[model samples]
Target chain A: MKLEMRDQPGQLVAALQPISAVGGNIIAVIHQRETPAATETLDVQIVLELPEGRLSRLLELLREQGVSVVRIDEERLLYECTLIMIGHLMHTDLSDTVDRIDMTGSAEVTELSLVMPAISSPSSARITIRSTTREEMKKAIRILRSVAEQKDLLIIEPLEGA
Target chain B: MRIAILGFGSVGRGIARAILAKNLDITVTGLADSRSGIIDPAGIDLEAALSRKDNGGPCGSLDVTPADVVAKADYDVLVEVTPTNVDDGEPALGHIRGALRRGKHVVTSNKGPIALAYPELRDLAATNGVFLRYEATVCGAIPLIHAMKEGLAGNTISRLYGVFNGTCNYILTRMAEDGLTYEQALAEARELGYAEADPTYDVEGIDAGIKLVILANTVLDMRTTLDDVERTGITLLTPEALRLAEDQDCTIRLIGEIVPEAGVLRVSPRIIAKSHPLVVEGTLNAVTVETDLAGDLTFIGKGAGSVETASAVIGDLLYIRDRHVQGS
Candidate 1:
């Protein structure tokens, strides 16, 4: 999030205080003090992580702090989970399995590593999925689980932080 | 305290050996195997009975049956360490009911009765003013049930999960370590006596599921059964699948989990980090209890073995002895 605030003594602190107040974790703060001296406005770029549905509240809080929003760059899919699937992957239309999660729009299969040992033996694949939120991640896993069930595949999910 | 023991098998013999090794002040008044039983108002000769059974014979006279020991024995506690019959929990269930009805404390390693019929048995114990304990039913020697029921009594347990089955753990450990296929690892486990000839119960997640049901019903105060568990076993696990987990510095383990609040009971092969406390080696078992007050507590110990399981049973017996029994 980029903000334009008064070029005053406590303006940057005021702008950053609202980020924490809204439960946003500030990753980086680029204060551009070298902006042209013609305008009495300071431009600060903040890279932050906010819990879902807090962006609008954060923007309102920033506005209340007399900070005008310049631009907001949103990285939606921040949550990821990796799982292992074992079965006849190629024969079971693996693309469709990946497509189900991708079609959700809130989640997508980000990476996959597959191993086919023999022509007749079961194949194995490691799938990494990214979702916009933890709830979406769970929904993504449920979709994958159902697809795996239909395919008669074994899905080995992570024990924690899945 | 004088006690009667039913099913003189590995666990029974282990209890007998522990009793002989230590002067724990426990008196075995009655003992029975499938075909025979011995009853003595005075303590039974455990050493002689052990030797007799070691020679491929019954533990005692065929004239006395296990039912006779349950009904007629003069004892304060009943150690029901019979083989688990998951179907209906069989004679072990009847024996447990008999002991509780006779106003006796009951400790068992049998998963069947506890998993299938804990509520009725618990009420029976309460009505009879006796204690019913089955610490050995899950995770062998971890003292998990005691810890949950006594140590962390007041705290709320939000989640409980870990590697509950040793046979599956052994197979997964072998598969991950040596890059062995499921078949090869299971064969090695069977040869090592970690798994039975028919490995379906252990490998199909039924054993872990049953343990989950037992914990859910007994400790977590959840009404759950084996069918309620969403189960996935290690049978279809491949060396390639293990390799994928290993490549990321993780390994696969059969984890049994119960979330009381969410009403979740599941036993499945999970990909856990190698550095996880629950990622125990060989046949070791580990459980992590997520409690509200004390945070998370992880317990690691031998999941199976005659002596290890007997440790749980003896703990339960001594618990009853210290509190309820009249004299040591």
Candidate 2:
């Protein structure tokens, strides 16, 4: 089985022990040390030789342990979505803001490009995130909205037709 | 949530792989083919299904037939991936309408039904209180459907344009560069798996034209008919004309351009300047949307692929799931 785990500190270790506990053999790990140029997180596709019957149990155990598991199966499908966040992207502690959304474990803010204006004005940013589902995207947006509220920055989503 | 895929072809098989690979919360409820749909609500063994398909068995040979599968099944999502006829999105339309009628959310990649009968079908969805997502119809893997449905919902789109047909563009570019005749370029494209054996849909611009109608209706909020827009296929371009385009530093692209000029809506093809961003995207389909507030925004990506298209299916699945949760 191959699983794409979001790149974060201790994610690899966390994902390993559960499989190792189930006596799964580690075939190969493809975690490039160098971060991707566009995204902050790397897609770590781990190939594991686990017992046939224990695969589902291993997946459940990983989910219970809060691993940011993107996909898990023979072959994985990765979906990436780009969203633009306007208003004081920096004033609200951008790193903390990003971290909160990353904590969802369903998705990670893979890429963040901030465009701050001169004279300390409000900022807008294009945040490219990858997730397994659209629910994760909405969850990420909710997390961003909470952080933006604390920073008093207005969050504007793409307008919907009436 | 439970999911079922009818017609285990490229799309059905690809979506099945996506769902199993992702290990999502939903369970595989059923699989329907010509014979009938197979229902296994608890969960399905994916490897076994693939093995059955590999052995040249019918789609539902794993467990049951398609007729029995749909009748004896209860699915939250019914994915219809049947082959579509240009004249009528047929069997697929029947499956989708049946699914919606049965109160199941329908998702499909079939463009024929959507381009021909979206308004009437959408009205049915509204009446049935279900969703009908067809992101894979226009541009596979690209989130154009989501972009219009959610991202730019507030803005009134004035016009939409893009290089929608990959086969035509590939043939044209090859004709321009390799000096191959239309037939030769089309043969190369067919050999490369870019164009179908009967490349009429791609070459005649019908495929792109259908997608253009969908985009125009949704984005511009205009009710456009297939007859309203003037269509010209790349089949008309000669090697000499393509050479002239090259001399002028422009590429001949089968562009599905829709602009609201005064009171009329226009969708047609024309040469784009080399400096244009779309020209640089080469081979990859790109769409530039002009909106009232958002201005001009361009989305570029792999417009066709089973995996990418499957990704869109998964997205719609999650969206419908969330809505189900919220409504509950």
Candidate 3:
């Protein structure tokens, strides 16, 4: 089977540690040299042969680390993440808002934007962020809202609408 | 499954290389060109054929011509990688039509025929209950066709636009960074194997326009024509103009767009902000698609070159072969 791991400085070595600890043989790794994921990481497509029984535990161990594992099909949880932020995105700062959300140790911001116009803008910005899991994403959003509030911006929490 | 390759050019040779490397459930029955088609059901000497081309006895000398090979052979797959004509769009249309008539599954990297006759050719394939896929017709290895056809199938595509032409993008990139004159940039592109010597189709935006039509058909299910879409080439760009745009933090690229709004289709170019994700650099091509559900999805990759394009064509072949085996 194949898996894509986000390339951090120590990530390639760290990813293999869990597999080696559980007994897995690495086959080939196709690293797209020029193209890297947004997290300043390269995409490493690793072919591996692992023991059938230990595959589940191996995946659990990998997830326990702060690795952005994209594909794992044998026996693992399908991770999903969502975040909602409230702030004066138009007035405060757009990049700063993204930076704060990304600063959270767990989830990285996959998509975001501020809806204000170029000339005249509202004092508040609604930002949506996606990550790997709901809990980690919620914590990231909380940190983002705190930053927004400190910058004198309003933070809007996710709410069910009519 | 038995497959035969015609016109052992860049595309054909690349496909042969991939099939050998992947060791997929496929066997190359024969390879043919203008000289002769070679039939080796057990698998032809791919390396030998490539070496022959490199040494230059014939452009492609398998053992027979495409017509003779298809007429006398019992092959299930026929891959046509002939030269693409800008005006007539001949060889591609003839070969594909003939293959479909013969009940053979056809895959092509030729854009001339598919861009002009997508609906008609697709209907012909459906009527015969055979597959006709041309993933290489658009952006080389970008997978834009399948990305729209399968990946984002659930959303309603409202707008489709991108840096579809690598040649034009390459020219613009040089012109922007080096402050090269349009002529200098074009000359550099021609020398660098990015632009053809003539470069009429690429520079006139006709090539990208055709790709836009194909993308519209797949992404929005809208039937658009090359003449229907408005096109503007980068030939008229001046260093002063590019500089002005750069000052505005915008890069000028020859972009192809298809916007289907309330049953109306509009295709043209506009200067977008430099920070726009679609504003990719160099020979790299990027596409930004807006879907109702998926919001905005972006894809970037090598948009041209024989090997990259051949990879896409072979991908379609593997997919078709898979379906055929599964169905049977």
Where's the lowest-lDDT run of ten residues in candidate 3 chain A?
A: A153-162
State how far residue B101 of model 3 sits from its true place (Å): 2.0
Over B58-100, each residue of candidate 3 has an lDDT whose tens digit, in order, gives 6344456777666656678788777676565686687788888
**Each model's DockQ score:** 0.83, 0.01, 0.01
Please list the residue runs of candidate 2 whose C-alpha ends up more than 4 Å from where it truly belongs after superposition: A1-162, B62-68, B260-269, B280-283, B325-328
TM-scores vs. true structure, each candidate: 0.93, 0.63, 0.64
Tens-digit per-residue lDDT, B134-193, candidate 1: 999999999999999989999999999999999999999999989999999999999999
Angstrom error of the Cα, residue B19, model 3: value is 2.5
What does candidate 3's lDDT look like per residue over A1-162, in tens digits?
344555557777887788789888776777776764456655667767675577778878877775556776443212333222333455567787778767764556665544433454332232445554556666776676568558755333321110
Question: How many residue pairs clash in all the candidates, one count each?
Answer: 0, 14, 8
Per-residue lDDT of model 1, residues A11-125, tens digit only: 8999999789988898899987886678999898998888878899988988898999999986757888999999999999999999999999999999999999999999999
lDDT of 2 by residue, B177-281 (tens): 787877899888888888888887788778788888777665566687677766656664555445544554654567777766533433334555566766634
True contacts kept of each: 0.87, 0.00, 0.00
State which candidate has the highest DockQ: 1
Say which prediction, candidate 1 or candidate 3, comes out ahead on DockQ: 1
Task: For candidate 3, give the docking quality class from DockQ.
Answer: incorrect
Interface RMSD, one decimal, each candidate: 0.4, 17.7, 16.6
